[model samples]
Target: MKRIAPAAERNKDPILEVLRPLLRDGATVLEIASGSGQHVIHFASVLPAVTFQPTDVDADARRSIEAYRAETGAKNILPSLALDAASDTWPVHSADAVVCINMIHISPWSCCEGLFRGAARILPAGGALFLYGPYRFFGVFTAPSNEAFDASLKAQNPAWGVRDTDQLLALAAETGFAHEETVPMPANNHCLVFRRL
Candidate 1:
């Protein structure tokens, strides 16, 4: 059965708006932590020219992704791969760009480190990595809501909480990526774009 994620549904359009100008036709986009698979379905429907490879660490999420692909009959959406951001090796070899939405804050900080390390290995020069989530700026929360969210996350798991934007950029720099842009999103989230150098 295909599970639904309300958050994915709400944020898909806003994410697409940013992706439209950045993505080129025929490029392969690898989506990390494709939770309910709703975002990939919506993106693939609109950007038919781009191939979408969705992956998740959870088996159920992959099933949901496969189900979404079946329901949509979208040719550009490929089969979901098993991938854990904290792993040193990724199953897929290469990609023109990567998209990870609402993942890092819910996972251990090591996941973010591994994500950038894996991205650096697979992406060629000038490739893009797009991330979406709420984050603190200069050790301060962007909004009160985000602060509460961060607190809740940390309460659940000490390793899980919204990361600092400056720390994230520094991590990316260590992995050979340069911070390109940060676009504000609805509900106090931000979309961060990076270029592999």
Candidate 2:
């Protein structure tokens, strides 16, 4: 059965708006941590010219992704791949761009580092890596809601909490990426864009 994530449904349109200008027609967009697969289905539906490769570490999530793909009849969506951001090796070797939404804060810091490393290895010069989620700026949470959310996340797992933008920038710099832009989104979230150098 296809799983529905309410958050994904609410944020999909806003994310697509930011992605429209960044993604070129016929580009292959690799989506990391495609939970519930709702976002990929919506994005593939609107951006038919672009192909979407949705991936998740969880087998159940992959099944939900496949279910959504079959139900939507979205021809541009490829089969979901088993991918773990913390792993050194990835299933796919390359992509035109990488889209990772709401993964940084929920996973361990090592996973975020691995994500940057993997993206650096796979992306060509000028390739894009888009990230969306709540983040701390200068070691401070952007909003009170995000602060509370961070606390909740840490309570669940000490390693998981909102990441600092400065730290992420430094990681990106070390990985040969340049920070392109940061667009604030609804619910005190942000969309950060980076370009491979």
Ten-residue region with minimum lDDT total, candidate 2: 1-10
- Each prediction's total of clashing residue pairs, residues at least 3 apart in sequence or on different chains, is 0, 0
For residues 61-93, write the lDDT of model 1, one tens digit per residue. Answer: 999999999998899999999999999989988
RMSD of 2: 0.6
- Give the Cα RMSD of candidate 1: 0.6
Q: Give the TM-score of candidate 2.
A: 0.99
Residue 103 in candidate 2, Cα distance off native in Å: 0.6
TM-score of each: 0.99, 0.99
Model 2: per-residue Cα lDDT over 1-197, one tens digit each: 78888899899999999988988998999999999999999998898999999999999999999999888889999999999999999998999999999999999999999999999989989999999999999999888989999999999999999999999999999999999999999999999999999
